[model samples]
Target chain A: MQPAVSHGDRPRLPIQAILRQTQDLPVLPGAIMRVIQLTGNSDATSRAIADAIGMDQAVTAKVLRLANSSFYGLPRKVTSLQEAVILLGFRTVRLIAMVAGTFTWMTRPLKGYDLPPRQLMRHSMGLALGAQMIARIGQFDPEEAFVAGLLADIGKIAIDNCIDGKISLMMQLGIKGGMTFEDVERTVLGHTHSEIGAHMAENWNLPQEIVEGIRWHHNPLGSGNSWLAHAIHLADVLAMVTGYGLGGDGLQYQLCEESLEICRVSAEDFDGLVEQFVGAVLHGEALLEGMG
Target chain B: MDVRQWNLSFGSQSGGGLSSHQFSVGLAEIRVVNGPTLLECQGIGSCIAVIAYDAHACVSGVAHIILPKRLPSSSSDRPGTFMDTAVEYLLNELVKAGAVAERLKWAYAGGSDFVHLASGASLPALELGRRNSEAAKSELSRLGAEVVGNDTGGTTGRDVSFCTADGDVKVRTVHEGEKTICNLQ
Candidate 1:
């Protein structure tokens, strides 16, 4: 339903619904999923992971060459995947997989949403990285946190495909309300990204934690499930503040008190997280470009 | 200065005898068949440029644009066509002109972040110029081409020229009473 208010004012909904409407979400690009499956301590050996990578020679070569590029800021050039993993680490590699494999899909022009690919990629990666920092500060599973952060807005693609003209309309309302894209999602789509993403998770049969992470990412204040969601919520906001990955939602963020309580993540701690997250993401940029 | 010694040339859709590879930022697509060519457009506030060159053929092409993808200046909805499509088209033309994909030297200019100072039409929360630059860079990267020169960003306007014969490009900025050469080193 249209928000029917005059253009000067319109309703903004939560992000859950926006997450509900993703179209052609970039899959984990088989090899990346394979790496995730193989990298476990028990499932496979480094040789196995190497074999899987070697099978897709193109992505592997690209990742290795990228890893060796100036992005890593390595004092010495790394010529092999083993060296890349040793240097960039497995967790970083996983994050890179998620980004490199998926970022391009985000680049598809969202006419209904009026968002270019680069806009969404920057926003999504910024929040994902921000969440990882917050989770690390709180001693939660940072890897899970990063994944949660990355998938926080999976519902947006769905929204763009489902709501016809609403995305662009919401974009206009967003500016009027001083609201972010998420707010527009809520207004136009009725729910928020967290809810939409949560539902998507349920459909995809994603792990229970990821589903909850999607649901509570924006409203972390009242979350009873995991600190990862709250951490991601904070990171999303922080990314906007730092000008890292800005979306339709700019600095019009109102801190979710309940989410803050759920994580017990302090302001001082958050400040530190932002500082460190910036450094890590900056370093990670090269790694993401050169996945191994 | 687009006519200076071994420095510059302007090109458009029609063939020009100026320098073998001079650049033209004017909205016309210019073609050159001899030596090299540099075509350009400048002073783009929220505009982007396309650079397609054949290193083997020693020829380069450029286009300056104002949107991400192309849409009608009137009412056609082509949101997925702008500097990106223009670059792709130019590149395809270069290939037809006997330019190798990997040998093209590429660069661009004229995008500035616009935070609309005045309230006129409803403005979305978009960094149009930044978006344009990103699209251009992404297309170039995908094609294995890197921007060798650029003078992007800021509130000031830009003017640029390209030399096809030698692949020399110049970018100038309008600041106060002087037009300063803005270099991206």
Candidate 2:
């Protein structure tokens, strides 16, 4: 499907201008950014990581609340950042901070895509859990997969923001014409959200693995061929299948077959993984609601 | 508390109480409810929702069916998990809950693949949405059920609700506004 020029003479905005909007988008807080950095450093002590979170009062509050929340059911209250970090483990605390930092834009309703409030947040949570589950089964780094899954679709925000109000119309046209969302995105905007999201990640100075996961998530074979990307790809499909939070495109995105191999799972294993993913999403929902 | 008792005991005299109560039908689950209960299911992307109603008895049921058939190794005992068993399970439960099988009417929505490969072809596993729709039609016929309304196949998700009080099944799509796709009465 050569980018359908069928609409003829529709004024299209340049991709460069669209990419520029992502600069205004908020990146992860310094505290959480440091936590992410420390997680990858084997020699980083827990106290150093705790000190990083303690620097941000807001992150500290959220981490304590999550550690004390029913999801953890801690016997005693976590009064300080160090206690919260120790109680929840450095990796878990880091994830909490990331989720907190990203929650704002993710929960907002993107009118261009006709997505309801919290739809993308829910989808991201679902994908995060799905990626973690696959990581657990495949013996990979679950934390890396979790972060990758959570941010894989962050580019959609840029696309929706740049597209203005044409989301619903383009969505309708895609559905009516039987075009994949990527195809529709390319047809109307020249570049897909993956590229836009990758640009956003670059602007934020995110880790290379995270950037590749977001960029190649929809098409792992096309780019860096990162296993993390494959995990996010499979997770996204499973998220769509379970209908965790459907946006304008719904289940209209193609499922990448190589993901199964990337995750080292067969089709039957994929089915079991889906059931596990659903359970994790349900559990994650309670914590997310508590965060609200 | 049972859904019926919980609704009736707290129900408003103005007929507003029971309608406020909603029961969610999750993946591969089914529930039979009597009026004025509302049964809701969400995000039926590649899955299907089979809604059956007996208007006269105010007995309605919904099945959120996930797959076309239950694989032999599937450990789930829930009958509503597959198309082959969903309608029969729903019908049996409705009858046991006071609906007459002969009086039952069916309506369904969901079974869409909004995602497809760039080559305009679906991977074999990804084609389940169309296959699910086909299995649903065949299963409905096999059970001799009358299907009165249908909204299936597209590149979108549907949020579905079946009101037992009036047997009204409403479907809301992402781009399309909500509509009462079928009524069993």
Candidate 3:
């Protein structure tokens, strides 16, 4: 896609080129990647995944701590990594690892976006928890939706990096010009964080569903078979409204009515879910501190 | 100046980390601070933060308001959650804390229309920051509290701080650095 030719004389590059120009995008840790790969296999056992994760001493320690923390409230003292992994299940373990590995990137303050340190991470986890709840309401797999929501804004990091700390100017222009942050980026930079995030997700070799979730979260109607995407869209809107880890976007993005229809979410249901979602977000914060 | 330096001056005054004395005002919650303290309201998207200060009395408070008005059936005891009731609560609390009702000065922040589609676009279900701010202003006018200053409306979420000692209301956002919108002696 052609890059937006901002206000100045500087030549604008295409989105693909901008992605290539990014310096050292973070990657999943070897152990987490191995666990992700192993979990995808039907024959993979809990013991095998635990052994793979055990290779990373830091992650092993965090996962064990999280398992033992009151967040889980497991019946007994879980001594072994294998036992903790089994109790938490593969998806929860993977999320713990993902949160741990990406903690720094997720926690760093993004200029111009008005996100203080860990604000984006807080928002990401809030969205993840909200998405899980929405997915459960729809009887879908909450785990998959959780991961989708967690990484939906991964592109914002790259976009923030590419803009070279001039996001504040872009944000100011958007606010004065009556434009959404996504629209401002697309108009001046020729790409929104959503698309940039999708490229990063593809580079990381994440599942296609997750890739689409990141790409189309802002506009899920265009994405075919966007059940997961719709859940994320609602979760994001709800999170923003409730001020859960909110940042520069604030309440500026458009809420897609189609997403509500496709996802079958009612206003009444949304209200009820919000109360539970808030508690879940607070609980998730405790888990987040443990991950760090 | 950058936020860090501005924060540092406060840090030196108190001889502690900024986070130590900082308190967040949640939805509908009102926190009254009488000593040298930095009462904060973080990440206000469409919501409004109503800050009232009486410097002479050294009594100040912040209310994080989520909605524009309070419904008749609204049963939440925290009056600060609604614009209509927030000013009343602030006035009452200030008087109880030794602040003269006629001496109160108010400052507003964080009513942003970050999502309005266009200048003349049809209204969405909620105008959010705009409505909350308007309601607060109208109610404050009715109660006869002088609104000293405000940095309301824009697309960015603001982290606001009101220090009780000097009644300095500092507004910080990503688009704009830290600026003291309201400074009272």
Candidate 4:
């Protein structure tokens, strides 16, 4: 798609070209990738996944820390990756590994978005926890929702890397012109971060549902109202509401109202949901501290 | 300057260089203070920051309210989590801190609907911001507190700072930067 030349002087690159620069994109760490692959294999055993995660010492340390953190409320300390996998299940271990693998990358400052160190990570954690809770309520796969929520904004990092200094200018212009951030992104870059993020997810061979969740989080209706997309949408809003990471965008995205219907969350229970989400965020924060 | 730094500089300047101590009120949290203390709630989106102050008593309180009402199943002891409970909690804390109940002035910021739904979308759940703001005003009215200012109902998030000594409320948004919305005094 050709982006409108609103800023004629500024260079515009098509989303395809941007994605073609594979080196600029974040590489899913090898250990995490192996775990993800194993997660999809019905024959994969807990010991196999644990051995794969143990290959990365840093990731293993983080996983152990999180497993021992109060977020899990384990009765005893978890000292080994194998024990963690057996106790927390392969799915939860995979989730923890994903968080550990992406922690440093997500914590980097995104000057284009005006997000400082740890701010974006905090927001991702909040969204991950919120999406997990909402997924449980909706009877969806909570683990998948958590991963989608965690990686939803990764496109912003990719955009920041590709555009460098141009994105901040676009953000300012968007705010000044009273346009939504996504609209400004589309106008200037031919794609919003959601689209770029979806492309990246696809490149990383993430599940189709997660790719769609990241792609249409801002406008789930565009995804034919997929439940995962809607859950991520609501979780994104919930993350903002709880004041997780209001960067330059700061609630600039639109909420898809049908998300509630798709997520099977009733209006009467919304307050309770907020309360539950807040509690989950607090728990997630504890896990973050453990990662430190 | 960035909003956070700008808020700090503004606080110190406006409080006559009293070495203001800033306390952040997080989600579903409330903070009450006296002297040159500043209570702040940042990244407020679809959440309300309900501010109450008594100029005569020099006491101020800010609550980061998440919802309109408390749920029956919610066992959270944090009063600031809900609009109705937040008002009652803030008022009680203010009075306990030497602020006169009748002399209290109220103001609020935030409760923005960041989601833009289709025109006919029927999700009432997305209206948490509006409901929070309405419930705040209604609860404050029920308690006979005079609301002096309101900066709410938009599609953007806000960062709100309240000065206990001067009763000045400064609201910052990505679009508007930072500006004092009201002074209860």
Cα displacement (angstroms), candidate 1, residue B107, comes to: 30
- Writing each residue's lDDT as its tens digit, candidate 4 over A1-292 gives 1122233234367777877753546777789989998987889998899889989898898889888888788999999888998899989998899899898788776666656567789888887888898899999999999999999999988787555557446656765675667777776777788988998898888889899999988778878778888898888877866667776675345565578787888755767777888888876777877454
Q: Per-residue lDDT tens digits of candidate 4, residues B68-119? A: 9888898788887888788898888888899998998899988887654545
Could you tell me how far off, in angstroms, the CA of residue B23 lies in candidate 2 after the best superposition?
A: 4.8
Q: Candidate 3 regions off by >4 Å?
A: A1-11, A14-17, A38-44, A68-70, A73-79, A112-114, A267-279, A290-292, B1-19, B24-30, B68-103, B116-124, B134-147
After superposition, the stretches of candidate 1 with alpha carbons farther than 4 Å from their true spots are A1-23, A40-43, A55-58, A69-71, A74-76, A79-83, A86-88, A162-168, A171-183, A199-205, A221-223, A261-264, A268-277, A288-292, B1-185
Off by over 4 Å in 4: A1-11, A16-25, A161-180, A241-243, A250-258, A267-269, B1-20, B54-58, B72-75, B119-125, B164-167
Least accurate stretch of 10 residues (summed lDDT) in model 1 chain B? B7-16
Instruction: List, residue by residue over B1-185, the lDDT tens digit for candidate 1.
Output: 32335332211112223454344343323343335444545334445555555555665566655455543332322222255566776677667777776777777775554333122233332355566778778877777775676656643334466555445556543222223232211
* lDDT by residue (tens digit), candidate 3, A21-63: 7666656678877887887787988899889988988768766
TM-score of each: 0.52, 0.83, 0.81, 0.84
Grade the docking of candidate 4: acceptable
Order the numbered candidates by DockQ, best leading.
4, 3, 2, 1
The chain B TM-scores of all candidates, as shown, are 0.68, 0.84, 0.83, 0.86
Q: Indicate the TM-score of model 4.
A: 0.84
* Comparing 2 and 4 on lDDT, the stronger one: 4
Q: Between candidates 1 and 3, name the one with more favorable DockQ.
A: 3
Candidate 3: C-alpha lDDT: 0.72
Q: List-wise, what DockQ does each model earn?
A: 0.03, 0.31, 0.31, 0.32
Task: Give candidate 2's error at residue A26 in angstroms.
Answer: 3.6
RMSD vs true structure, all candidates: 15.1, 5.5, 4.9, 4.9
